[model samples]
Target chain A: MVSVGQHENIEILSHSEVEEVAGFVGNFKIKVRRKARYVTEDLCTGCGLCQEKCPAKKILSEFDAGLGTRTAIYLPFAQAIPRIPVIDRDNCRYFEEGKCGICAKLCPRGAVDFEQEDEFVELEVGTILVTTGFDLFDCSRVSQYGYGTYDNVLSSLQLERLLDASGPTRGKIVTRDGREPESIAIVHCVGSRDKNYNRHCSRVCCMYSLKLAHLIKDATNAEVYEFYIDMRTGGKGYEEFYERLQEEGVIFVRGRPAEVVPHDGRLVVKAEDANLGRLLQVPVDMVILSAGLEPRRGAQDVAHVFGLSRSADGFFLERHPKLGPVETASNGVFIAGACQSPKDIPDTVAQAGAAAAAAMVMMDRGRVTLEPSVAQANVRLCSGCGECVVACPYSALQLVEGHVEVDETLCKGCGVCVGHCRSKAITLLHFTDEQLLAEMQGALRVLEVA
Target chain B: MPEPKIVAYACTYCSYPGADLAGTLRIQYSPHVNIIRVLCSGRVSPELILRTFREGADGVLVLGCHYGDCHFVSGNHRTVKRVAVLRRILEYAGIEPERLRLEWVSASEGERFARIVDEFTETIRGLTPIEQVLA
Candidate 1:
């Protein structure tokens, strides 16, 4: 991530989102809304004084998975690109009551600008790469997991922050009360591979659960119980790592836990142990729900803006599953990472590389070969009925001087307008009426008689 | 009768590649069906299907991308409405409506495409030839 930010050719538009996209692939006009940071980019030295002096605090930190609090003006993380802090205007006291302005006074470089407004930037680009990553599925939705009901039951991401060296707990495996956990229960496939929620298998949970089990065991030597439906370690050295975790005394229970309930001030994970052929109730101080990766909240909005299609599982669909994995149906717009599907870091990196290469290929060519099978309008036969104009999904057909005209550049050769043309003015070039009739006749074995 | 000849019209973006994937995966289905690739399933007009049946086709299959997943956005939307009306016309014309099937098959659904082709071919086999229906 730092390397991408540091790249000379790369311009990182941090805290910005695509507002509008227009034009075709190589000649796209993009409008982006860069959210207000309230801090000058060039003037800020990224000094920690302003963050420490900010009076408004206790706002739930999004970076910490809501497990920790943050000040009004603070960087999202320690290694944030550009090292600039964004002011949470909603939580800032100065914005609320117009009294506190300690962050501006404490800034050695005077970078804080409370009056800063959201800026919109319009750019012309040849190609685009959409790498909007996945969001962890809300474990609370699976009510049986008792995620919100039990203080000890936490999502894998929250546990990740707890285990991080610079995280909220400063790398401590403990319960909500800050006490070292005597035992931890890790449940795999929290919302994945379940018919009720998501029918697809989240490909990364099993291995990550193993890694978490290993880390928790090493950190506190807690009796770790792994509840899983299947231990899928498909990657190279992944199965070996799973074996190593087994060697490290991690008790692997092959079963999906039925429910997590509070018994006596502690969470009891009730599950049917498939190997033992009996039910087991394991009491643990901390429970980690290995939540599945899902498409981001506004993924549909993003897909609409980019002219991309989504699969049944809600991730952005690639042009082809095998041959054109990084490409989309939309020309020059590529997708990578978990936005395409739930994949691990290694797979994400590989896909990101492929997407970059695909974009580069388009940029280097400086031209696109238009599809030959585009719709063509016969002005002589046109009646100016304007039905084709309304039927065209691409808006490529128009009535020019009382005659239908086809914009070859925008036409995707879908032939929808041809189907709706009452006057029979429009004809898709390759799939013309004559050509299609010949093909159909050939298919029906009637061409010989005809 | 030498297995009934079925003419299947598949869109280039989704169903055509889906059929190719079935071959790549080596999933065998009925050999009676011949696939003709069009730019979009929306291109398969009611006239085209009726003419194919009039010529000699025992069955006609129209395949496109799943809903909201069309390469040409809303192309399959038009295909759905067109096929729905065309099925009624087929039934009124004394033709078996089941002989003409419209289905959504994405590029990734190779096994599904094979299964649909096999199932549709079996249905066509159960019915009399298009010659008998026209007669």
Candidate 2:
């Protein structure tokens, strides 16, 4: 898809979902449901001509970090690959009461096709790579951050956009009241490194917070105060950057900002300077809470979908931490980005490249040699009890045509189903009863041989 | 009289190396023990332990890296929980749970490894034969 986008020939099938996955590692037949975009992709030139003509323009742009407004008929992002616009069906005029086709009337390419129906596509791929990424911790759950209650207190991601050149304020670091103040306090470890929330140090926030401080300093000329319990700048060039930031006269408070109270139209941060052993209240114009990374909302659902395992931290479990960092316990599936753990941009990109390489390696192999220890149903002895089907961890066993069939590719050779089969219907190929008995006898035969 | 058949499932990272250390150090513990090296104690399935007993082994010993010292970072945690649950299952099935044991041994703990094996073998020697329990 990235290659196609580079060539500008990308036909993005947006609003699509994989309904089912059937077949093996190298021979997967994935059934995908491409929901109606309500606008034709092949014909849509994404000229922004239709969006200007359409009256519905009040929808919140989820892509713009929800800080800016977007039209109902709009492109998701500037570099949005197919350059096609999707109609917000709920808010669209024609969808509501057949009142508006202004988008259809104004589109130069005649791209607006209201009668388009949902499509089902089956793709054949040698391998599958999952890089669903991660979601930011919602600060509202913590409640102490005053995110929704106070307008000035913003999440780290929100601050990223707010401080970004392409942001709502056009790169100006200012509060919602439109005043750039003299003092700004950045709180570290908002949702992470706390047992109450995520216990893991988010690994990236420290560096990004430094970046934000530099950017904010350059933009606002404000006296920036970074309150952190522990300054974690362990990555490459990170500690040096932190040192440089210190040399540049940024206040490095060895403490965590406990509370943000609204006082005199400014946010007053109450925190303890652990080194100084005294309470300090710093009044600031804006507060950027360095929120942590969290598991994606449907992480467990995706785990179930792929029959993968998750660690206690809810990140996808790698087959082996050192040996197979990118690979899952289930074969053919790989994980990258914060889906595995909290990582900085360099680490995330490295993992992404590794995951891509791993996927490419599998693809290059053409066909994966499945473990011979997969469970096989002995149809003659099969009672159709369906006990083994439930016992199989990988969902390798399924009742087909009133008989149990083993999906060789999906099985991990755990042999749980072999034990569950009351009628002795299922047998793991390499670890079959006969083979195991022979191995046992061989081990015992050593005594006689000696 | 037959020697007591002992199956030792040693985690590759620590306990397996510890056994090798014991051998290098010439620590005479027990010739009855037959070591089976696994990736981690987490990789030692309950079925493998049960299968060892079914194969006429008098005792099964699962050794892993010490708690918080697992090479795979908490693979032994799952091992601990699994072995704990498996012990209950063994007791329920009329087998003495003492027949199966899980312990943490580091790569440097050669003397500790010898001690563990000696102690566990002595405990198994005091118990009835696994065949008698099964019968």
Candidate 3:
């Protein structure tokens, strides 16, 4: 991530969104809205003094998965690219009550700027690649897990922070009471492969659970129990790692835990041991819910901005599941990572590389050869009532002078306007009225009566 | 009764591939349905369906991507509205509305495509032929 950020040719827009997109494949005009950081990028030398000096420090750090507290002005994480801090406007003392500006006073570089507003940037690009990854499924929605209500019921991400060397506990596997856990229960498929939440299997949870089990054992030598419906270690070397975890004395239980309840100052996981056909409740010091991955919250809006379709699972739909995995129906636009679907890090990296290659291929080619199957308007017969303009989903048709005109680049050859044009002025080439009628007659010529 | 003749217009981006996948999977559906590939389901004008019925076809099936899954953004949206209106016209013309079926079939739905084809063929076989309906 740091290498990509420091790339000579790449200009990273850290906190920005594509507000508007116009034009076609080879000539796209994009408008990006860069949200306010309230800190000057060039001026800030990434000194930790401002963050250390900020008075408002109770806000939960998003990068830590809410396991640690952060100042109002802080970097998302220790190794964050650009190494700049963003003021949390909602939580900043000066922004709220207009009293404290300790961060400004403590900044040795004088980089703090509370007056910053959101900036809009325009760029002309030949291709676009979308890798807006996935969001962890909200574990609180499944109340039976007792995630928000119980102190030790941590999501997989929260556990990740606890295991990180730079985390709140400094890589110690401890429960909420700041003591090393005697036993830990890792619940797999917390919100995945279930009809109630998401039916799709979160491809990475099983392996990550195994890795977490190994980490917990390494850190605290705790008795780690993995409760899973199926142990899907399908990737190369993943099964070997799972085997190593088994060798490390991790108990694998084949059942989805029904619920987690507090019992005698500890958490008890209720689950059926499917292998033994026995119901059991095991007491544990901590419970880690391996939550599934979901499409980002703003996925629908992003799809609309790019004119891309989403699959039944709400991820950005690829052109073909097997053949055109990285490409979308829109030319010059490619999708990668979990934005396309739930995938592991290795798969995400591979897909990202493929998407980059696809984008580069389009840009390297000087021009694009569009299909001849675009809609054409007959100027003489066109009434120009603008009916087709409204009917066109791609906004390809427009009223020009007294006739309707087709923008060849924008038209996708759907021929929807051909039906809306009362005067029969518009014809989609290749699939025109004559050709379609002939094909229909041919299909019915050999009909057998019942 | 002899097998009914069904002409299915399938969008190339989705339903056409869905039908092709059915073949790849070796899923058996009634062979009475002959599939024609179009750029989008929106390309299947109301005139085309009426023409197929007038030409004595037993049934017409229009298949496209699911809602919000159209390759052309919202081509299937137009297909949905047009098919609904056309079905009403068919019912008013004394033809069984069951003879005209519009379904969403994505490229991954091979089994669904097969099932729909088999079901539509059976439905058309139970109905009077287009020539008989006209008479």
Candidate 4:
């Protein structure tokens, strides 16, 4: 990211969103809306004075996943690209009560700009790639886990921040009462692989939970128990890591916990160990829910803007799962990372490279060929009934002037409109009624011989 | 009706592959299941299903990807909605709605594909033949 920021040919527009996209493949004009940072990115030398002396320190740190507090005017995190700080306009006293401007006064570079408006940036591009990433499933939604209710119960992200060297506790595994825990329960599959929640298995949680168990044991030597339905260690060298954790005395319970309750000042986890066929209520000082990953918030809006489709699982759908994993239904658009599915770092990076390569290939080819088997509308036979328009999934058909028109680029030749057309005005190039009927007859004939 | 012909529309991505897997695994199922591969179950319109029924097929089974696994994003969504409305239309037209059934079978679910085929065939066998019902 630093190299990309420093590169002469590359431009990084931070705190921005793609507001509008127009045009087709190899000729897209994107309108990006850059949010007002309230601080000059160029002038602000990432010197850490404004963050330290700022009076508004009660605001929760987003980077810490709400486990730590930060001042109103601060960067997202220490290692954020460009290392520029953004003012919290809502919590900033200068904006609210018009009183405190301590960060503006203490800044050495005088880079604060209160009057900065959101700037719109327009870019013309050949191809587009979407890597919007994912959001961790809200653990509190799984009421049985007692995530938000129990003080000692934490999300995996919170434990991650706690395990960080520069975190609030300086890598200490302590309960809310400021005492080191003797026993900790790691609950896996929270909001994953359940009919009530997400039915898909979150692919990366098992390995990361093992890593966390290793980290916690190494730091606190606490008795760690992992409750999981299945330990999916399918990736390279992942099973070995699981074995190593097992050797380190981290207990593995093969069951999804039924519930977590606060009992006698400690959290009691009730689960039926599948292997033992016995129910166990283990009391622990702290509980960490290995939450699942879901599609990023507002991914649907992004999908709509990019002319992409999201699968029923809420992730961006690919063109073909086996052949074209990164390409979307849209010609010039591609998808990668957790936005597509819950993948690990390696898989996400691999998909990102594939998506980038797909875009580059489109750019190199210069032009794309429209499929010959596209739908066509006969204007003369049109009855002005818009049944075909509504039946077309791609929104390629439109009733213009009492006649249906087909956008060749948008149509996949699915033949849906042809079936819906009462007047038989619309017909797909290859998949006509006669052709489909012949195919169906050929398929049904084999049973007649018996 | 001799064998009660059943026409099944199997999606190429999911159900067709599942059928192929069942063949490879030598999973025995009813021979009455006449599978016709389509790009998606969504591509099988109500007209095609009605035509199949008119052609003396006792039952029409539509199978595609499980929910959330559609290769065309939400192609099965269209299938679900189409079949649901078609079922209601069939009921209103005095034909048994059980003649048409929709099932989801993924590529990895070979056993499920075989079971679905067997179950649909049985359901069709239990019903009055389409020829007599519409006569």
* Most accurate candidate by DockQ: 3
lDDT on C-alpha atoms for all candidate structures: 0.89, 0.79, 0.89, 0.86
Give every prediction's interface RMSD. Answer: 2.6, 7.9, 2.1, 4.3
Ranking by DockQ: 3, 1, 4, 2
Candidate 3 local distance difference test against the native: 0.89
Task: Report the C-alpha lDDT of model 1 over A1-450, residue by residue, as the tens digit.
Answer: 789888998899999999999888998899999998999998998888888988777899999998999999999999999889998889999999998899888888899898899999999999999999888889999999898888999999999999999899999987888789999999999889998888889999999999899889879969999999988999989999999998999999999999999988888999999999999999999899999988899998899889887876889989888889999988899999999999999999999999999999888988889989899888899999998788788888888899988889899899988877767788899999999898887766642332
Contacts from the true interface found in each model, as a fraction, amount to 0.63, 0.01, 0.64, 0.18
* Regions more than 4 Å wrong, model 1: A94-116, A378-380, A383-391, A395-407, A445-450, B1-8, B15-35, B49-68, B74-135
> Candidates' TM-scores?
0.85, 0.73, 0.90, 0.75
How much DockQ does model 4 earn?
Answer: 0.22
The DockQ scores of all candidates, in the order shown, are 0.43, 0.08, 0.51, 0.22
* Candidate 4 runs further than 4 Å off: A19-23, A29-31, A40-50, A94-122, A193-195, A227-230, A251-284, A303-313, A376-411, A416-426, A443-450, B1-135
> Candidate 3 — which residues are off by over 4 angstroms?
A108-110, A377-390, A393-407, A445-450, B1-5, B18-33, B66-69, B74-105, B108-128
TM-score of 2: 0.73
Using TM-score as the measure, the top candidate is 3
Q: What is the TM-score of chain A in candidate 3?
A: 0.95
Q: Which of the predicted structures, 1 or 3, would earn the higher DockQ when compared with the native?
A: 3
Model 2 lDDT tens row, A348-444: 8899999989988888877777656567888989988887676554577889878899887677665556655667787777666666556555665
